[model samples]
Target: MALEDIPRLGCGRSIDRIWGTIDRPPTAHEEQCDQCQTARTRLRRLSKATRSLRESDLHNPTMEPRPGIKNAIMDVVRAKVRRGSRILLRSADNGTTEISEQALSSLIRSAAAAIPGVHSRRCRIEIRSAAASVADEDHPTGTTGTSTNAGPRLIINLRVAAAPGIVIPRTVEALRHEISNAIPASVGIGAGTVNITVEDLYDV
Candidate 1:
């Protein structure tokens, strides 16, 4: 698993710390902290899954996901659920539209993965306070999925892994362009900047 994908608790400690304690007694701190104990329980289930996968002969023709990858991704999604981190699609006199971060993340990831030779790793959307963005003065709400630029201008950051031997610069540029166009269309708001980081090169 990529080190960056490690799941961290709300206290900022990685869950790997919990996994490390599998063979030994829990520390005094861990024993006292309910958060660590709860995370440990979840990690134990994941540990069982990892052990099972290690014993299996199955292998993906492309690349198999590393152990704990799903757990780590689920942690982020659960965090969003707890915090209710959401984006305002658009604000109009009629009403305001909003989407949860988890939903938007899914949409953005799907869009990125659609690009050939690339696989999306992470996507983050930052909302910026801005002037009202209405499609037209007459029909402020606009048509379905046509707010164009809705409530707030957004700054989007993306990290993707490209297949080895691909033209990194050209592919990333296409990714950036695609995201800039897709986000506004998918949601009501527009992305002011789409920042792409080709963080990893994976075997084809």
Candidate 2:
């Protein structure tokens, strides 16, 4: 059932129970109600986000917010919290459509993390013109005049931690292949490069 149907499920107590804000377990009515089940799933995700926040603060005890930083963060958090992970996609007709970047990244992350020894931590998406000048590279073709434009190429960078037993080169290759296929198929954006950086290796 949808969230709108929750009130019809007799009571809203299941949400409180899921968060441990209530002392009792899910009552019989909540146990059988599909609306309550959906609500519980959403609430659990929020709970995990809360725990992640706590862990993050613990790791960076010295990092304090600067002026206006809190508002900037809340703006981002509120947008995602309300609408999930959506991004604007431009159309040739000058109209825009909404697409779920979160959905694409989730698939990519799942594919990478499914590899036996790899766990993905972060994924960043960048779109660059195919003919864009390489500022960091030494090249005579570097643009000084008004340039021609090419279609955008999508680049993905993943930060991951690998387990000790994995072979480094093979692991990176597997990750790249998985990401390459997932991005084009899921998001309709062909990946120019799928870069993986092994930031940590866990002990066996």
Candidate 3:
């Protein structure tokens, strides 16, 4: 049954009860209640259908999205990628600063994509738990400069697709140079290792 067809307060309780009971043992009343059981069955089926549709949309967008669907779809994609591992960019008297691995990866990809023949792929940023030391630059003294006071050091892993006939070493070096200049200045964190993997090659 479509969600709208299910009465909002059916089964002698609000739909919240159905939501609250998902993936857990149902209460005594719910176990014997026909309406609640039926709703749960329908909802589970609906959930599976939703997943199938999402997979289809992801793999089969061969043509331009219709009307305003492109932006809507992109918004959903961005929201899904927004959260991941986090880093302490800096700390101060009042509070601490932080950024997600997603943000850091985006920065790295932007740098890599700016190069002539590199297509950015998956990127990851990790903090070495054992590498935390006092960064010199964290201060509340009204300085506009980025904190030299350190946070945990980062390890970056980047995968890219190289275009045919490009100088691979030179391209990777350029990505490294760009990343080195961009990451620290953008977020007051230091990097320990940047592992670049040339995972694929494609025609230009």
Which predicted model would earn the best lDDT? 1
Best by TM-score: 3
lDDT of 2: 0.66
Pairwise TM-score winner, candidates 2 and 3: 3
What C-alpha lDDT, on a 0 to 100 scale, does residue 162 get in candidate 2? 90
Could you tell me the lDDT of residue 106 within candidate 3? 77
Write the number of the candidate with greater lDDT, choosing between 1 and 2: 1
Tell me the TM-score of each prediction against the true structure: 0.54, 0.46, 0.55
lDDT scores of the candidates, listed in order: 0.74, 0.66, 0.73
Model 3 Cα lDDT, one tens digit per residue, 1-204: 555544464556667668756668777877798887877788778777888988887889674468647645754575477665577776789998888777777788777867888877767676764234323336467665453534676778888899989999999998888887788788766665788999999876
**lDDT, model 3, position 83:** 68
TM-score of candidate 3 on Cα atoms, chains taken together: 0.55
Model 3, runs deviating above 4 Å: 1-84, 130-149
